[model samples]
Target: MNVGLGLPVDDPAALLTWAKRADAGPFSTLGLLDRLVYDNPEPLVTLAALAGATSRIRLQTEVLIAPVHRTALLAKQTATLDRLSGGRFTLGIGVGGRADDFLATGLDVHTRGRRLDEQMSQLRRVWAGDAYGEGAGPIGPAPSRPGGPEVLFGGFAPAAIRRVARWGDGFLGAALPPRFMDRLFRDVEASWKEAGRPGRPRLVAQTNVVLGPDAVVEDARRNLARYYAFTGNAAHFVDGLLTTPGRIREAVTGFTEIGADEVMLYCWAGDPGQIDRLAAALHG
Candidate 1:
């Protein structure tokens, strides 16, 4: 299975260094998370910068908040970056769960799911040169690829999964419990077949990781609390994926065994040395 690393550096210089080093590492892609107002920079903006700095690593938005972005503008931005990076961008998008984010955007959080559906449809239209309106032909400049970056949909609901089969080129996010994963993957395949699509969509799942023989469960517990607070899936949110170095390796192989095309590791290692050590363990 293809393996990737989530880059979540708080410092810009350190982020750049890690992005560059990650490209040099064995990872297949560099996944970045998106939040409009946060410690980290906007994902697409950060990705544009990384595109200029790295040559080969495929860049991705692990989950871009669809409600906050202007659909057409985001399409253009992604296209420009994909062209800049020579067709190395994957747009993984979701209807975000953060109510505070919607409140900050002056939008009703309750409508985010519908907004995500609409925005995704609009993005496809803009990318395909469909008229933006009666007078506007389309947004430009066109991406180097015939279509813009491939869009992957992520979420853990039936509605979200249907959208993945309907609109997205791929499905993303982790699967919980081996049985649930089997069912979800099977359902997605059936959905694709039902759509009369030719083949199964790309599948990627992320496993949270913090590597060290000395790593404490408290570090994971603390991080899990923060994650659960953000995503609100407290039951499965924090507890399922967080693991020690040895457990992480086993889980990665387990995900691979379940037929995931790629497995993204959410590296929570606190420093550069830790990141290097973790990468070495996975890469080696």
Candidate 2:
């Protein structure tokens, strides 16, 4: 299975250093997480810098919250970044649930799904045309890719799956049960077939992965804590689910079996040394 690495870093120089060493050629793609108040740089700005620093590694936004920003402006920014990266950008978008973010933007989280749907429709229209005017066509500074950056929408619910079918070029799976992953894929495939779409869209799943027997227990616990915290799940359950390197491999293999085209493993390492060890194991 194709594997990508997503490292959430707080420092731009550290991010740059990681990208440069990444020229070692192990990861298929590298992604940045999008969260404004998390003491992290903005995803597109970081990726714009990455596009300049690296030549071949694919750059991704593991997801940008669509409801918080204007759709046309977001598409333009993404297209410009994609142009700079020579079409190596994949725009992963989702409706984020952070209450602070919503409060900051003064957007209603209750209407996020409907707002995203409208925004996506408007984005496609604006990307495909010039202005919403008569004399204009083809937006200036178009993306290096013919139809703009590939859109990867993420969510696990049935409604979410349908939204992806309607607008996204692929589905990005969050932390979901194995059986539910199967159901999600099935729904997507059925949606494509029903729509008479020619080929299946890409499917990428993200999960926390541990790579060593010598890995620090505290780091693993912290990783589980953050993972569970995001899902509102209790961190205690993850210890039994992914306690060993063998268990990690088994879970990945199971995801592959369920039609995951690529698996992007969040190294789950909070310390510096853990990064190298995790990458080495992923490369191996």
Candidate 3:
């Protein structure tokens, strides 16, 4: 299976370092997370910088909260990135659950799913050279590939899984066990078939990773605790991270066994050295 790495948004200075290392390493994609009320690098902006820095690695938004931004603007931004990256950009989008994120955007959290559905349709129109409105012209500079970047819908609910067939080119699953991921992947495939979609939806799964010395591993755990505190079960996530080479290999193998097209390893520790370690663990 194709393997990807998630950028450490906690360290902006280390982003380019991670980008260059991942581009030179065994990674198929360099991805980052998105959060409105948190201290995280904005995916598009950071990935744009990364696109200029790396010529090989594909850059992706592991899952950008779609309803948080305007559709036309989002389309223009993604198209520009795709052009700059030479068609190596993948748009992983979802309707986020965090209420604080919606509050910051002045949007009703409960309505985000509907808003994202509308945005998905709007994004296609905007990218297909359609006018923005009755008088507004089409957004400038289309994406490198037709239909803009391939969109991967991320979420676990039934509606979210259904989005894979309705609006997305694939399903971007969150960090979860093999059984959960397998069930969701099956659901995504079932939805695609039920919708009369041809071929299977691209299936990508994510998991937290941190492999290094005691200090580095501990740091990752601490950061994860705070990062997932909103979940009210931070310990479950913090303890579930793949902290060893054996765990990493097992996770990748499990995902591959489940028929995932790609597995994105999320780096909680903002250290470029993790790239080599990852390569050694997965490729050796």
Predicted structure with the largest TM-score when compared to the true one: 3
Off by over 4 Å in 3: none
Model 2 / residue 92 / CA error / Å = 0.7
Error of 2 at 95 (Å): 0.8
Q: Give lDDT: candidate 2, residue 23.
A: 45
**Whole-model alpha-carbon lDDT for candidate 3:** 0.90
Write out the backbone clash pairs for model 1: none
Q: Cα RMSDs of all predictions? A: 2.4, 2.9, 0.9
**Candidate 3 residue lDDT tens string, 1-284:** 79999877778878998888888877999988899899998889999999999999899997899999988889899999999999999999999879999998899999998999999888888888788778888996899989889899999899998888998899989879777799999999999999999988999999999989988898889889988999999999997889889989999999999989999999888777889999999975
The model with the greater TM-score, 1 or 2, is 1
lDDT of every model, 2 decimals: 0.76, 0.73, 0.90
lDDT of 3 at 53: 95
TM-score per prediction, in order, is 0.90, 0.87, 0.98
Which candidate number has the best lDDT? Answer: 3
User: Candidate 1 vs candidate 3: which has greater TM-score?
Assistant: 3
